[model samples]
Target: MEKGQRMKIVTRTRAGTITGLMVVVLVLAGLALPAVAPRSLIQDLFFILTMLSLAQVWNLLAGYGGLVSVGQQAFVGIGAYAMFAMVILFGWDPVPAVLVGGVAAVILAVPTAFFAFRLQGAYFAIGTWVIAEVTRLLVAQWKALGGGTGTSLPREATSDIMGVELIRTLFDVREAAARDILAYWLALILTVCIIGGIYWLLKNRLGLALAAVRDNTEAARSVGIDTTRLKWAVFLIAAFATGLIGALIYVQTARISPDAAFSLTDWTAYVIFIVVIGGIGTLEGPIIGVIVFFVLQSALSDYGAWYLLTLGLLAIAVMLFAPKGLWGLIAARTGLRLFPVQRRLVGHDINGGK
Candidate 1:
């Protein structure tokens, strides 16, 4: 091969190898880090997973299906509150309780999708916000759960596990460390499972339909696709995943309240920010964005308001200059992917008439 062709081959090979290595490393690190890392590190990893999951769900809807919703928090709050009700009131195990909360969120999404579907574009956004606010108010006023103030799992509250203990004292560093690590692993597993499920879904016919619907609903429908039904499916799936993440958050933080649980500022902001920065419409983008966001947050948290201001500015910059997002930009330019969800061209068709 000529020098230029040889260099091209070398570049492609290196990129492909590095991409595979990166994915392997990520999966291994997620599975093993909590078991060996210090408590603080494990906690941080858990937070990253939570953020990543949020970004992925948002990407699945808005990025892939063209569903921009400002009220995903409705499912988040539902997941948290449902977990509380199941574990505390019904005396269910935390693990099963989390799944129950996820199911409840999925169930609730039916009605939410029904009503919210009536709106379009900005109207849809407003409808979602209204629905979230109403849900928040209803949960807050229900005194049995904690009303507006909040709800708490008692200090001595124990799940069905006979010998397992709840960590109550931060001063007990060892105990806190143990609990944090366990929680970290739980979050990691949940994140991996959700991402894997998404990957499997996207590789199927539904995934192609979702992509078509996102790119151009009118064109998609003209081709005999059921655009409305596809949107509803995306909505329900997003709600289910968001709710499951909420339960994971509650389990790790060991607390939940209507206000904090349903807070849209960070939840909405992070989801959008992550998907935008990482790359919308690509599964890899959200995960990458989560890592970048968490690192920035941890590094600049001491700066307080400045940290948030920095994030806002960064997000705006990403949107304006790189709408495909950071991951998307890289994928477009470099043609590298950790998961390889789509195929790209490096060479033309061998059988071309030309």
Candidate 2:
């Protein structure tokens, strides 16, 4: 062996490379879906992307940050309302209004964290739920936004939305088709950004510190890691992202109401189900989880109670038998990763060494 042979540390594998390439192909294909897919199909994909984005954000906070929040619908509702208020009162365009939604969520999160952080475990979850309820009640009193009856995006508002005209001209489709396509693209971009941003964070020193904080808070503190600050950051960031997604969802629907916007089942419970059924910690988990969720909804949603029961049982089975999730199972068997963040060390054996 050579005396000065070199070694390499790689974070990605050959299989991971292939997996990544496949993902790129799929994303590119998805971008073109509006051209060939029906309006309903585009809407369906938009729903999946938006939900997946929410699940990914939740997983980052609870699965990785150890901040389990049961009232994420708070941010969603606030964000959606903020956008509605902007469009209705201020005449802001929907595209730029989403940013305001994110900012509003972050603002709401600050006070919320001050209260919720004082509690632990189940108490913290309850604290969040209470906060969400309070927010819903407050929003319900804002008569300008139709009080509780809700309101729809006026035809003029929807028609003049950013990129709608361009999309209509580009695709030679109706106004509704253009809107669906625009929403789908926005959802796709948001999901990719959330997953990519989280992956990048997890590959840095912050990831290691966050992991330590998650495993044992006191232990992390003993090593001088600011566990409290890290947790707060994760919570606020998740809230901000969730708010943006919520606003986008409402924009796509062109309708809003307090109950629907803040519904536990629609915004929080279903998101939790998606994250749990997907693998919790890994980025791929939510990706797989959302796919599974979509399939289940497509087939069993008509059954109502039976559909929910099946989902409940499926989550329980995953928890009991495959605690890591479907993605975890596949990864265990094939060692394939699309977003490989785990580090590995590889080196040649020294010449004539044992």
lDDT of 1 by residue, 194-219 (tens): 78778767767778788777777788
Compared with the true structure, all predictions reach lDDT values of 0.78, 0.89
lDDT of 2 by residue, 1-354 (tens): 445556655787787789778878988999988988999999999999999999999999999998889999999999999999999998889889988999999999999999999999999999999999999999999999988888887777888999999999999999888998999999998888888788888888777788888788889999999888888889998999999999999999989999999999888888888888889888889989999999998899778898888888999999999999998899899887877777776556533343
Model 2 regions more than 4 Å off: 1-9, 349-354
TM-score of each: 0.87, 0.94
> Which candidate ranks first by TM-score, i.e. highest?
2
Error of 1 at 15 (Å): 6.5
| Residue 9's lDDT in candidate 1 | 14
